[model samples]
Target: MKIKLKIWRQRDSRSKGEFKEYHLDDVSKDMSFLEMLDTLNIKLIKQGDLPVEFDHDCREGICGQCGVMINGIAHGPLKNTTTCQLHMRSFNDGDTIHVEPFKAAAFPIVRDLKVNRSAFDNIISSGGYVSVDTGQAPEANSIPVTFEEAESAFDAAACIGCGACVASCKNSSAALFTSAKISHLARLPQGDKETSTRVVNMVNQMEEEGFGYCTNTEACQVECPENISVLNIARMNYEYNKAKVLAKK
Candidate 1:
């Protein structure tokens, strides 16, 4: 396929960014989106040009690190698909593809098609895990959790912290990402002990990281590769409110 790319290029966070145009005539229909990028980079390198830098690890769509805005959509036009899993076949022969890094105040541009998402790590560090001492592995049936509860927690745990939620939100909200981390543990026995404190700390940390408030637009879930529910945001609100009430005592 012959594809025209209008890609954002920036040397660093402080540098000015703008779209640069390039044409690719050799993109294969079977090539993954990242593979197409590799072909482009190879052509650029042969001409001694700086190749576009984008993040990718375990390009099988499991790592969630290969996200990019494609044609104004997060991770391309397909529902619940990551960029690395996208194929050139999705586009027509003469399509103009606009590729850019995930944009948000919290996700500062590192270079062409690369953004720093460490704010997510800061939110997780605040209280996303079970800190209690369990000492050793317990029996499988010891917790007595119902199957429904386990499934719900597992669904929430499916979030991969890709920051697509933030990038897709009009307000640049991290609510979906933060809430998934909160809801997963809040539903589990091992994490219940610190639920109140965990919710409080993590929510606070999310705000500190400058993420905008969620207004129920639900754009986050629409672009989320994991299809993590916005209901997790409701669960997080419940936990946060419960935590605030408990702290008054």
Candidate 2:
């Protein structure tokens, strides 16, 4: 099938970006979205044109490095699917698809479909660590954790920090991502000692990094690829407020 793509092109963060259209023929419905891009890039390279720059470490979609806005939706139209996992079969023949970088104040455009997501690293560094030393590995039963909490923490930890939540939000918020990180640790025993400090510092850092406030739009979870629950955000809020109130006392 034939497909048309309107891809955002920019040389750098300081440059103005625009959608550049390309028509592709003989597109296979079985091709992954990134694979489709690869075909386009190969075509451009053969034409002596610079290939479009996009980031992807693991093509299996676990790295969270390949995220692009497709048809104005973060990670495309498919729910809980990463860009690397989206297949051309999802679109009809001769359809026009718009692909662009994730847009958020914290995630400045790098080039083409790549954006600078280093702000997420800064936010994690702010308070995403536990100072406690568990030393060597312990026996399986040494620390007993309930099935519910363990599963919840595992789910929360599935977040790859893809920033789709920020791009999909009207406010460009990172609350979902931040909350997942906070809850992943907070649910575990090792992170209990630093719970108050972790929430306060991470929240402060999120704001400082220019991520917007979450108004419960929930576009984040819908596009999250990992299906990370927005309940984590509520947990983050609870942890933050509880920390503040106790700090006052």
Candidate 3:
């Protein structure tokens, strides 16, 4: 199969970005999206041209490091699919694919398809901690947690911090990401000690990061590669309110 790619290229965050088109031929439908890019880069390197730069680590969809806007959809048209896991077969022959990085003020473009997503790192650092109480392994089952509670926490923990939620949101909101981070900890017994403080600090940090507010548009949920529920946002709000009421400033 052959396809036309209109990819965004930018030298840095301060520079202007625009689409540069290139034609790819003899692409195998079996090839993963990144691999197809590898083929393109190989040709570019042979000609001494710069290759398209994109983020990818582990390439298996577990690590949220890889993401891009494909044809105006986050992670392509597949629900809960990351760019690295996107297969060329998902596209038809002679199709024109628009490839671009996640566009949000908090996520600044570094170069060709890569964006600096360290804003997420800062948010996680603001909270998402268990104070390492002795580092000694506690006996499993010391605390009685229902199976439902455990599963809910695990589901929230499924978030990989891909920033797709922000990328897909019209307002560039980080509520889904923040909520997942908050909910997973709120659900776990280990996270109970600082739950109130955690919610407040993380939410504050999210706002400071220049992220927009969630208006329940549900775009984040539709594009999240993990299929992390937007209900997590509601959970986050509850936690924040409870923290404001109960937690000591």
Candidate 1 TM-score to native: 0.97
How do the residues 103-154 of candidate 2 rate in per-residue lDDT, one tens digit apiece?
9889999899999999999999998887855788768787788999899899
Task: Give each model a TM-score.
Answer: 0.97, 0.97, 0.97
Q: lDDT of each prediction vs. the true structure?
A: 0.92, 0.92, 0.92
- lDDT score, candidate 1: 0.92
Ten contiguous residues with the weakest lDDT in model 3: 128-137
Q: What is the lDDT of candidate 3?
A: 0.92
> Across residues 36-113, which tens digit of lDDT does each residue of candidate 1 receive?
999999999999999999999999888979899998899999978899999999999999999999999889999999
Candidate 2 clashes: the total is 0
Which lDDT value does model 3 have at 207? 97
